[model samples]
Target: MSDKLTKQSIEETFRELSNWGRWGEEDEVGTLNNVRPEDIVAAAGLIRRGKVFGLGVPLDQPLQSVPHKRWNTIHTFMQDGADVATGMFEGRLQYADDAINLPTHSSTHWDALAHVFNDGRMYNGHDARRFGSKGFPVNGIEKMANRMVGRGVLLDVARFKGVDSLEDEYAITNAELDACAAAQGVEIRAGDFVLIRTGYQERFWSRGDWAGHTTGMAPGLHFESCYWLKEKDVAAVAADNYAVEARPAEGEGFSYPWHGVVIPAMGLTMGEMFYLRELAADCAQDGVYEFFFCAPPLNLPGGSGSPINPQAIK
Candidate 1:
């Protein structure tokens, strides 16, 4: 065969063997967009200047279902020869602390990519390699670091319903999210860290059996909603509930399918149990949803998740 014919034959043979004709190649999704790296850095500056708002719950607050072992502590002691000076320390200095066992399945926590799997794969096509002596790759809290300084938009769902709180076990739907944003005059943007306040943050601790009283997104998170947010390129989706997705995903017979969709397929992160009472109050007073938001997770390698202190600046 001529040189050109030989090349064409090879290409055709490879395509036939690989079934390339039936496959659609698309661009892989990344974590930086509507909120750029520079944007997050700038937002950090605003937070330092105190021009932002805080949206995280106090670490010491009894907002989680941590085992009793993990509670932090302080100790004071003096150097042997330094006038017996007293110093302070916290956390279980000598023993392992387990009090803050990340709910991994409950309210107000970030789900690592290892947290779920769809078609048997984790984020960035990481497979069983995600699990090891340490844990899942990109599935732990470490991958969620430096998440501050995105354009955050709030969806005040409760306010739209004229109620301070939604019914227990309430699941937020795509329509509600859209309506809430519309009421607040905010537009969803790519790379925006979306914050949905179900007004449950206010009742935390006060509610008997703290975990039981919480609300969540309703079962059906409309695939279209996930598609929309993914298309917009959000870094993460957050809410005031424990799980970012509603319980009992549509016909899936399980809760928090949003985790599967956002994390693995879309490579998006989910933030839950965010404190929004103060942030909501400020937004209500200011009548705006655009703010500089920042969240830096504790750097704990191989940790399933980390305690986050996220803030939002106007």
Candidate 2:
């Protein structure tokens, strides 16, 4: 497109890296099409330790607030009774139901192909303006509700580089990703859900430094890494930070140009703000990088994204 992420790089990259019709004209699952039956069986074989790691941040908590335009969820709980132990029939049988007003992309969530657009087109050249307002008619998250079952590989870039974390706003290049994979002795294969940890969550969430970190910069992938993802045929890629790519890009451009290419053009799903501390710790402890990764979003049709409770079983 624009030759290595310079000016108008997003425009050209969108065209070059596109998976617009790779799966057919009506394809919706996009890169998730990489996962096959055998891949699931192979992922099951990795569950020898019976250890489970929660890969989602806790919702309705203090750390829920993020910068930019996304708003935190408002959770409201209701019980049949007026108060605890004050239920009808002497507080005996009590039940509670909760309703939540949530923004689909707020917290730990997977971005659907409809999340971005390029040249007024969505995945498979779907017109963005017409369908987007009518509710993401083509490649909404529902298409991937049943496709996210497979193996997950964690590449601890921070730990591999012998640093507590990458420098704030550092743009991680493709070479760094390869070096991390090589250092871990893990061979990334097709249909693998790759998790790139920046040590951001562990650092920011712990010290209540959300203002310093969330308000402005983040450390993540460079826009050029999209080509590497295409080459690998990776089912999906995620990170512990927002937008997967480093914020405040090097050249003058939109906020998240990588997203414009990866989601709308390439039809690839992306995850963000996953809680990977414990998972990375376990991986480093056992020197095992592959595990059964599963995270299914709500079957809400037209849902742009959803808060997920992804699990990594080792």
Q: Which ten residues in a row have the lowest lDDT in candidate 2?
A: 1-10
How high is the CA lDDT of each candidate model? 0.57, 0.83
Q: Show model 1 residue runs off by greater than 4 Å.
A: 1-29, 41-52, 65-108, 137-140, 208-224, 248-250
Report the lDDT tens digits of candidate 2 across residue range 172-253.
8889899999999998898999999998777876776555445567788887799999999999999998778887664435
- Segments of candidate 2 deviating more than 4 angstroms: 1-7, 63-68, 80-91, 132-134, 250-253
What does candidate 2 score on TM?
Answer: 0.93
Looking at model 2, residue 148 earns an lDDT score of: 88
What lDDT tens digits, residue by residue, belong to model 1 across residues 65-146? 4444333322234323233223233443432223343433333456554555655665555574547776654446665565
The all-Cα superposition gives candidate 1 an RMSD in Å to the true structure of 11.4
What is the TM-score (0 to 1) of candidate 1? Answer: 0.69
Judged by lDDT against the true structure, how good is candidate 2? Answer: 0.83
User: Which candidate gets the maximum lDDT versus the true structure?
Assistant: 2
